[model samples]
Target chain A: QQPVQSPQAVILREGEDAVINCSSSKALYSVHWYRQKHGEAPVFLMILLKGGEQKGHDKISASFNEKKQQSSLYLTASQLSYSGTYFCIEGGSNYKLTFGKGTLLTVNP
Target chain B: EPEVTQTPSHQVTQMGQEVILRCVPISNHLYFYWYRQILGQKVEFLVSFYNNEISEKSEIFDDQFSVERPDGSNFTLKIRSTKLEDSAMYFCASNLDREPRAFFGQGTRLTVV
Candidate 1:
């Protein structure tokens, strides 16, 4: 089953902060985050493997909680480049991924 | 940085015609996958191929759809008979190893009329 993402859409200003949450009904082995720009392919942001582990690069970061089967993506000091749809996919056995409903984020300058 | 490359960035096909989308995943990546996205819709999983064989496929990847790793670097998705609903953006992705992180190609915009 696909994971569920909160706040279907978000509007933010440059230099603002935003958080997109993803919740899964089943246990999650790995959570992969991607961002898709208009008419482009989804770009890989990061992947979190285990619970309680936090990973970040630049102003973007994410946390995974296996116990809750949830993950959250944090975009700090947002940039115009951050305007896109975010998808949190749950990776299951055999490397298969189930995609979540994306959270559309628009960052205006 | 090595990236996945897809051919024919945009393809237009008539219904009932066969269409093939080609991709070259990053060399040395151990896994390959195909995904589809309709206009304004969430991406959907199509299939995954590993070790020169299909490791998994989603319900969306039915009899009409087939995948092939014809050579060492080329991965292809073929729709035997196209339909209007099959029109979408097709993306090819690759993973280095056990890590679930994937690198996606620019994508092929398929337009079936």
Candidate 2:
């Protein structure tokens, strides 16, 4: 099943912070984070597995909670470049990914 | 860095016509996937391929849809009969293993008219 992402859209000023949440009804084997700019492909950001290890990319980070079937992506000191649609994909047992509707993040100058 | 590559940045096909979208996954990647996104919508998974066969496919991948790894490096998705609803940006992705972190291509914009 597709994961549900909260805060359908968010607006932040440069140097501000934001948090996006993704939750699924079914059990998740892994959670993948990707960002897509207008007219561009979704770019892989990070992947969180069931073990609950937190991963980071520069000012962005994510954590996976197997018990809650949820994952959260944290963006700190957001930059203008961070403006895009962020999606959290729930990986199935067969390695197929069901992606969420995505959260539109807009970082202002 | 290694990245998946898809052919024909954009394709325009007539209804009822057959179209084949090609992709070249990262050389070392073992798992391949096909996903499509309609205008202003979420990316939907169509199918996944491994070991030269389809490992999984979604309901969206129906009788008119098929996938193949024609050679060592090329992966393709064929639509037997294109429909207006099939117009979307199709992305090809690959991962080194089953864990995660898939690299996606630029995507092919398929417009069925």
Query: Whose lDDT is greatest here?
Result: 1
Q: Give TM-score, chain B, model 2.
A: 0.97
Instruction: Candidate 1: list runs displaced more than 4 Å.
Output: A66-68
TM-score of chain A of 2: 0.94
The residue-by-residue lDDT of candidate 1 on B61-82, one tens digit each, is 9999999999899999999889
lDDT of 1 at B55: 92
lDDT of 2 by residue, B2-113 (tens): 8789998999999999999999999988899999999899999999998888888889999999999978999999999899999999999988875467889999999999
Clash pairs, candidate 1, are none
Going through the candidates in order, state the TM-score of chain A alone for each one: 0.96, 0.94
Per-residue lDDT of candidate 2, residues A2-78 (tens digit) = 89998999999999999999998866888899999988999889888855678897999999885748899999999
lDDT of 1 at A14: 100
Highest DockQ scorer:
2
Q: How many steric clashes between backbone atoms does each model show?
A: 0, 0
